[model samples]
Target: MKNTLIVLSLLGSALFADAAKPNIILMMADDLGYGDTGFNGNTIIQTPHLDQMAKDGIKLTHFYAGNSVCSPTRGTFLTGRHHHRYGIWTANVGHLPKQEITLASMLKEQGYTTGHFGKWHLGTLDKVISSKGAKRKPAENFAPPWQRDYDRSFVTESAVNTWNPGAGNRAKNNPFYENGKALDPDDPTLAGGAARVVVDRAVPFMEQAVKDGKPFLSVVWFHAPHEDIEAGPDYLKMYEEHGEGAHYYGCITELDEQVGRIRAKVEELGISDNTLIFFCSDNGPEGKTPAKRRQGVTSGLRGRKRDLYDGGVRVPALACWPGKLAAGTESDVPLSTLDYFPTLGNLTGYEMPDARPIDGQNIWPILAGEMDQREKAIPFIRGNEVSLVDGEFKLLLPKGELYDLSKDWSEENNVAAAHPERVERMSREIAELLESFKTSHAGADYNDPEFKPVGKWKNVGSKKK
Candidate 1:
């Protein structure tokens, strides 16, 4: 309790810090689980800085990703709208359309320098890599970050080994790109833990923006604890006792170190009070089965990634903006990465246009501790499986298994049998929402003739029969 007072007092002191247009930092983890960080009650992993970051701001108890997987969720974060509206139904399926006005583009227009660092699964960043006599077909998938209006960027199109990213087997061959050029095998950061390189590029970008006296929007998406996960000897040493799975836990700590680095830089630059830093995972843990050795934990949640269950969609979310947020406070109000666009838009005075359909609500009121309940229900869709959640009541579609999340967060109880009217209503709502996905899937959302959906793409896990 004493600690809480100290933190709160510090936050109060910064309530009037210089930030009419605050700098924003959005950080995301790949395949990180709901209960994997120190702030999220994972005692085994050491994330001291992240836990303190949460204490200095708000920890969202019921935060969710835009989607359960990578590309779709990323697309959702970039645009204020859901990914299905833009044809990226699954990872590696479709590119982020040029027509979509992304948060970076919006902030760039608002006099903010925008940069993206780390994994950019929204689209391929290159044309091709030719180790063989023939070339691969990312040439057909080229939509680099510069084209998306990111002023600067250092990113890989997809996942890479967390340790020693550049040298690897065929699957770990994703190149690290800076702007439009390759990172030039000589770059030292290319050989380290994934987060190390990510922050290496990120800090400089923020520093440049600070030097220019411009508010910046930096998206640092780390590919740690994802597939092909590995930890350097240094990070692995921190978890020497976890045996083979130590790689997962160790790399997370490494990533946390970078998080700490970012926070310290913000403070060092005297911008901590005016900069909003948000951290979250893209989804729940990877691999339901033990042998996947992903070693990811969802605390005691019911499902892993790629499901309609809460564990699949719920993620650990922390937001810290010292000037405007109370310290050590938590809000159970449902929030989504989809809300970042609208919330930041509202704070920065970029009004959402009336013509475009956006799913996110401006959650600045909730972040400021003035609101409790979310204004709109959060709809979770993967292929044809849809889950319509109106507050605690989650109505799973197709079979209508209803669960009150407030009572059974693990989702062990199906209350649909007891609440017929609720089931019928939420089912009707899910059906209506599914029709929206179908309309968007049919390319109705694309006003540009150049925008194209991958016609033959299948979700692989789509339950749509």
Candidate 2:
């Protein structure tokens, strides 16, 4: 009887351990550069909270945003698939099709409460509202309000205006309820100007999940330090001491404070050990005047926002899961925001819909130090331009510039001519991938004009040139 009782107790413990799953919180900052946070070796601005989070988590040195721009990067995060697959390659255009499955929808199936607070630039139209209103045709003027992605979402009509910095153009009637009443549009606390409103909504939602004893996934995407830079008084003071570009620096400082609050709340709720927090930016800093550039920070990488250079796509990335990920350690493996869906699904035992191809792989093994590197290369595309990477060797085409990233981090030296064999192999591989992708979006091109190349690369090394 003693032996049987001991065996039964062991079985019960194993079953309970297997049932435990971690809650997830993903925070994305708009237009935050690679060198903005102190952990990335920034000495100019104070980001004690972000710095602390980096210290407590595993800092990802080579993590990328998947795309070099906003809307598409967010799309990748939600789908774990390439944004180009859905024809979402830029910002403020259309909605992610309702047919497509999203991480939020998948998590909902696993009994997780999901919420998205802040910038939802993925799609402009709200299907719930559009279906009730007069029939509107698809055009530049008649765009949707929100993507059919999340179960509960508080998203902006467009990127929030940080210049004038007020809550303008939010959906009337609130559509979604808060405290049994529609949220007040003019309520300064819920305004979309700074990080406060998004953080405010997120904390309460998380607290409620705790009370309900349910696992939750909350995404807080902040629209700050993006454009028309503005700063609050308290944050302004930090930049004032620097005596130049105080406004831009102040905005970042304010963002840091909000990050600190979220971290504190997790600890207060005693969920720090069971909650995984992943923080990153959508893209790099937007190019501006030197004064503005002084306020904006990058990790000395070439190019700014909207470009395919390392600086544009490779922004700061950090993940903290307390007991799971070793504190104060850094992983140099290249990881993308696209991997979030698969990673989260694996952690929560949520089986992602197997109907469509998933571009992201499960990086949990890499994160847990089981694997030293990814087995396959990651591919990126924007318009006709494409880039492919195999380990440290990267071949960027349409320009056909090749660089061994292990040696050249800034991409100043091109070795495309030196290694013709590598160039041909990668180019052919990319060509085959593109051919397969074209067929996937054949019927639904939306007849939008083909993407035109925008920066210096278009003139210097493009096939058009």
Predicted model with the maximum TM-score: 1
**What is the Cα root-mean-square deviation between model 1 and the actual structure?**
5.5
Tell me the deviation in Å of residue 360 in model 1.
1.3
lDDT by residue for model 1 over 354-435, one digit each (tens)? 4566777677767877556777678877766777778889887666689999999799999999999998887777667656
Model 1, residue 448: distance off in Å is: 2.9
Model 2, position 338: C-alpha lDDT score = 83
The residue ranges of model 1 lying beyond 4 angstroms of the native Cα positions read 1-19, 129-137, 170-173, 290-292, 442-446, 454-465
lDDT of 1 at 324: 70
lDDT of 2 by residue, 17-130 (tens): 576667889999888889888889988778899999999989999888978888889888988877766666566544455555677777777788888877766543443433
Candidate with top lDDT is 1
